[model samples]
Target: MDLLSRGSMVSRHGLVLLLLLLIGCVYADSDDQVFLEINDHKMTTLSNMSNGSGRNEQICTLCEDFASQTLSYLQDHETQTAVISGLHQVCSKLFSLKHQCLTMVDYYVPLFFANVALIQPEEFCQKVNLCEMMASLRLPNRDGPCTICHNLVVEFLTKLKDPDLQLEIIEVLLKACGKVEDHVQECKKLVFHYGPLVMFELEKFLETTDICAAIHVCKASQGAAVAATLLADA
Candidate 1:
């Protein structure tokens, strides 16, 4: 199975991806049940590609492919220029990937879905004229939980060995949701009541977070600094 790593070779259309059908994970129960089976799930490829189950391997391979092939499709056809372009600027920075990695559909899919509930990603997909194309996949449907998205993040955290870079990306996602400052105040208010706990929880939630990991650190850092000052003043 092909993987997403700094040194991994990416075929333009992921003919490697084309050979497989990526089945996105579906919740048998609830979000809380997600990690219950973490032990059963195979070690991610980054850690030990040789150790995981066929299913887990498929998830990693497919996800890597999804990130690759989908973006290739979009780029070739000019699917969602605005959203695609915006995500390009963000994902590469967050994941410490080259700008070329923006071609990975799986990389940005969760971030896109992260906004769907609150921001209606459909609007952006429509803007890019990819609504119908995405729906045809019949993967998780509209109301499904973000299981697949979580897996994608783990692929990055596990596959990419730079813990500092991973942590940075995770922080960007948790606080900035794409690492963009568009909603820092909302995040600040949530963290204000339980800053340490929220930070801790965020660490655990790193794998499954829906944050877009888009913005520059300065954007979120400055906004967070201002919020802290306001809280101190109060």
Candidate 2:
């Protein structure tokens, strides 16, 4: 069978197994029984995969494809629910790490989704050790004032999912804006204007807005247009 066919088969079988496991757990006598049953299921599936040559390569390909597709969907949708659902769907297709995939989805998906704006597929694959040799992608330098402002906004947005760092992040952004010597007022104004909105409706803001442009810090082909416009108006 082709990879697509194989993937679909794996996914269907995995989902069935998942259903079975859930049903079995409901009747099991103890937590240990449930845990052992899950481990046994996972080991059996993994052993089947390991029986063939190029199994490692197949697993790597599935993982890379999953990361790429998940990131693409998250970029387009920009919501936690979209990413979580995509992760679960893709995870079901994997020939190995079935249980770990579910666990990682719960623990790491939030962090990955939070930085979806900044992350690249290859970087994510590498981070999970699924594609070790791929180089990390980097964003270009934001040397212009408005670009700097936009970067700060992106930085703040990327960390919005972390409640523990919310106050510290706000302080950092404010301090960073305070130091922009050339456009100190504009920078701080953008922060003060959008800061509360970010706190209240982060996912909606991400889904529906180009925040930097909304703040007048970035424009198509004219990164410094806002500063120039302010000067011309003054």
Most TM-score-accurate candidate = 2
Off by over 4 Å in 1: 1-47, 55-69, 76-145, 162-234
Q: TM-score of the candidate numbered 1?
A: 0.20
Residue pair clashes in candidate 2: none
**TM-scores for every candidate against the unseen true structure:** 0.20, 0.22
The sequence of per-residue lDDT tens digits that candidate 1 reaches over residues 1-234 is 111221212221121121111101111122533322331232221223333223233333334433443444333323344444444444444343343234344453444443333433333333322323232222343322233333334443343444554444333323322222343343333224333343343333443223222121123444344334432442
- Each prediction's RMSD to truth: 19.2, 24.0
Error of 1 at 31 (Å): 44
Cα lDDT computed for each candidate against the true fold: 0.32, 0.43
Error of 1 at 169 (Å): 18
Q: Model 1, 148: alpha-carbon shift in Å?
A: 2.2
